[model samples]
Structures are given as structure tokens and as C-alpha cells.
Target: MEIFLALLGFFSLGLIVWLLLKDYATPALAFISVSISVACILLILEQLGFGVGAA
Candidate 1:
């Protein structure tokens, strides 16, 4: 489950980068979109009791 979320985040980040490089998104929009995705991933992990410091 954690791996899935991690992969999802990775793919999302990749997509965002592609969009920016392709001129499909503004810098601010890309930044905000990535930030929101990261925040959502963290929240999901936290809700699942997966702390960043955990092994």
C-alpha cells in the first residue's frame, strides 16, 4: 500500500515535470499542483500510521 502511494507520487511528479517541459503548464501551476500532491500523499501515509522515521 505504501509502495503504491509512493509510486503514485512519483508518477504524478513525473507528469508534472513533463507538462512544464512541454509548456503545458505555468511554473506557478506546476509548483502548486506538485505541492498539493505531496501534501496529499503525506496525509494518506500519516492516516495509515506510516511515519517517515519508521523502518
Candidate 2:
């Protein structure tokens, strides 16, 4: 899905940011990025009226 892909991209971007800030520690960056992306995707979906079978 387009939304899913966007979410993944957002997470990847966050991971990159984290890595930059933390000097390239992939593990911690990956976890924080995933959490941020999931939260952002859920929020966007809810706002768009496509969340939880509402579409």
C-alpha cells in the first residue's frame, strides 16, 4: 500500500537522522525510527478516515 510505503520511508528517514546524531549506531536508531514511523502512520490514517476499517 502507498501508505505503508510512506510509513516505511518515514521510519528510514528517522533512522538516518538518529544515526547521524548518535554516530551510526544502527540498532538504537532502527528501534526509535520504527516507533516514530508507526505512530506517524497510525495518526495519519486516523486523520484520513481510513483507520480501523473506517474507510
The estimated TM-scores of all candidates read: 0.51, 0.49
Residue 17 C-alpha lDDT in model 1 = 72
List, residue by residue over 1-55, the lDDT tens digit for candidate 2: 6876776678678766766766556677667766786676675686577788532
Task: Give me the displacement of residue 37 in model 1, in angstroms.
Answer: 0.2
lDDT of each: 0.66, 0.68
Worst 10 residues of 2 by lDDT: 46-55
Check candidate 1 and list the clashing pairs: none
- Model 1 is weakest, by summed lDDT over 10 consecutive residues, at 46-55
